[model samples]
Target chain A: MITFDDVVKVYPGGSTAVDHLSLELPTGKTTVFVGPSGCGKTTSLRMINRMINPTSGRILIDGQDVAGQDDALLRRKIGYVIQHAGLFPHRTVLDNVATVPMLLGKSRKEARTAALGLLERVGLSAEFASRYPAQLSGGQQQRVGVARALAADPPVMLMDEPFSAVDPVVREGLHREFLRLQKDLGKTIAMVTHDIDEAIKLGDVVVILRQGGKLAQIGTPQELLDHPADEFVAEFVGRDRGLRSLSFDTAAGLPVRPLTADLLLDEAGRPVSWGDGEPTGGTFTVEDSLRLVTDLAITSPVGIAVRVDANGKADGLVPHHDLVDHLAERRAAK
Target chain B: MNLSYLFDAAHWSLTADGSIPQLILSHVWYVVLALIIGTIIALPVGLYIGHTGRGSFLAINAGNAGRSLPTLGLLMLMVTLLGLGLTPVLIALTVLVIPPILTSAYAGMRTLDHRVVDAARGMGMRPWQVLFKVELPMALPVMMSGFRSAALQVVATATVAAAVGLNGLGRLLIDGLAVNDYSRVLAGAIVVAVLAVVLDLILALAQRWIVSPGLR
Candidate 1:
């Protein structure tokens, strides 16, 4: 667990960058610090690694004061990722990932072997091992950044807008892959971002800060979305938070209607285009979030979402009207 | 305007004093020593100022002072003070070599992507490690160009050493002029220009070989 005990960062010019802020970030969970520009979210994230020192107050990891440890030794025990990857342009992809391991005194060959495995884990192929960072696309370079951070397998990871530099489509893919990796690894993580949607999607605890480094609010993504502490948070989370909250709800318990003759199918029992030759609406599995289910229902020409089994065959359908009723009941219950 | 002295076998002979081969070797030697000494002095100072962001004014002013100093005047002054010898010539030439190297090293380190440096620091690299492993490697292309410019300046200016009775390529120009050996003067001018071009080309090749292809 990481604890910030009334930490305050004031620059030499007498301007406070981070106010007397206090918070606790739990272990094995992802906590995101999010705010507008100059809100001290990045400042707070950087303080964990001592990149930005707090003018006063203490930052502790597992009840030990971080200020007491040697700076380099303290940093080596944590993983850090930043926007644009911040990779060494002179090093090959393999060597870049191997850096921290080598710094910790691992032999070159051993570090490289471990780095290759990390490359694959972060969705890179063996072919990318020898290429320089410039040779890879922006998304590919970000993946390498992640691989490099995970090289030492530190118990904690600090990310400063790690995927913000990539395009939205690539960012989504990275988000999915990142969550999958986190699920498997369960490392204590602290991330900073300005994107509310990203914070909701990835953070177990979302910390919203306002200008002057003051805390605006702190809660789960659902709590923040369901009931923002004030107008500022509501505005910050964006105007569509009600619709976005549906993302956390699973569609598994929703009612599904039996498939009708109007539903078109192919020889393999999969949904196909209607006779008009246009493609049928997108499919939603039982495990998909309600947001996707609602999208599938709204877009279907026949007013029903095709529910596909594991084999991609149509199992059932969710009528558009039924989704509306379920969402209404869910909101009323809250 | 006569150029026959360049092709004349007597000028080319190693045994003759002020021969093309002898003059060329002496000229190259002066350039090499000045560059080595200048770099040894300037490189570390530039890097230290750049890395710490301290004494930047010193780096900037040093470069401007180097560019403005009159090389021939400095050589004559040094010769008067230190007496006619290699010391006066070398001292003058070495001054010309300092600015480019110092300024380039400082500029190269200053302009690197700070994000990369931050990442290096955040990843637990000691300050010295960051300087050597990250900053120096990235700054090499710019620093090398600085070195090249310094070398070229040293090569062209070493000829001024002949004013103080030093034996170098400049001797051809000084002696030829005294005896009205216009052909020898032309030959000296031609050889010096060619040497400058060849040295610059070698430096360019060295830069290409030393710099990581990833940077390109």
Candidate 2:
């Protein structure tokens, strides 16, 4: 757990990077700090590890004053990932990941073993252990960077726009990987990014900052989408955010389709023949949201419809009741 | 000019055909000894300059000054101080190796990536650990180049010992010059060049081993 009590940062040139920012980052959850450039999201995240010291007030990690501790020691207990990965070009991937562990007095063999395992956990093959950072692609390098951050298994992770340097496709890929890692590790993660959709997809809680490093808002994705604190946040999360609220809830139920031999063959399961009775017409063709379902119950149709695959077996069969209930639930969540 | 003369010279130095073989043996030994001693003196000084980033002005100026010092002037001065012997020649040769080495080592260290060093510090490394583990590995290739050039300079300069009547291949050249025998001068010069090239090749291989590819 980390708490910031009116922490402020004033640069030597009299620029205020963070202005009396106070927020609590719950432990075992992912909180993303996001805003435009110079908004101080990165600065705030760095303060948790004492990389950037606070000018006033206090930053407490698990209630201990982080400023009083040795900076190196404080950093060792807090995982940090930066853009470009900031990996030591001189060290191999394994040694790069093991840097903190080796410094903390772990034996070389022990550190290497831990690093190799973390690399594998982050989706890298053990063969990349001996290779250098230059050997990995952008996405692979990001994974190795993540692996290095988790090498010590710190209770909290601090990321400063780590995925922003990669291309959109790779950025999205890294976002999914980060989500999986966060789910599995359950570390108190504080990531700073500039992309709004990324904040929504990866953040368990999103923190939005305004131009002057002022706290604009902080809330769960659904809450922020449903109830933005101010116009700036609403605009930043974008007008489409309300539509995004649909995926927030846990999926209610799966539609039931007819049990047919051909569909079952494609599904690679046991086949059951369709009788005179329909499976309540809850199946819709894979292609009929805006076009022909060949048989689908949609906006204009009130009755249930059964859609079949090329093999004449049920693929997606939608019922009017299921469709109406699902839409209503989605709209209400929004 | 013939195999007999070579065999005769060899036997003379070791098995008593003449003192010529002994003269040649002593000369080779002198060159090798001076190189080892100079390397010991220079490597530490070079590494220190690279690490400390201080006194570089004096050190670099001193190296250029040493290189500019005429071997005859250096030898003549040393002869006055230490007397006409192997010690003066060795001192002069050692001073000759310093400039190339110190400059290159310092340049290499200064050029290493600050980001890598910052990352090292961020990972909890002490200042000394950062220099040795990070800076040194990055500096090795360039540092080795310095040593190679210095060693070559030493090999070429070692011949100056003959000007003071020391025994070396320089003695053969001196003897040949007195008798107007150009072949002996050519032969001695060829041998020195080949020796320098071979030593450079060895150091180049060592450079490969020292510079980890990833850092490059």
Quality of candidate 1 docking, DockQ: 0.81
Clash tally for model 1: 0
lDDT of 1 at B64: 95
lDDT of each: 0.93, 0.76
After superposition, which runs of candidate 2 have C-alpha atoms over 4 Å from their true positions?
A250-334, B1-96, B161-175, B213-216
Worst 10 residues of 1 chain B by lDDT: B10-19
Give the count of colliding residue pairs in each prediction. 0, 12
| Tens-place lDDT digits, model 2, residues B111-152 | 777656655665656778887878788787777777788878
Query: What would the C-alpha RMSD of candidate 2 be, to one decimal place?
Result: 6.4
Instruction: Give the per-residue lDDT digits (tens) of candidate 1, residues B9-33.
Output: 9888988877899999999999999
In candidate 1, the second chain superimposes onto the true chain B with a TM-score of: 0.97
Q: Flag clash pairs in model 1.
A: none
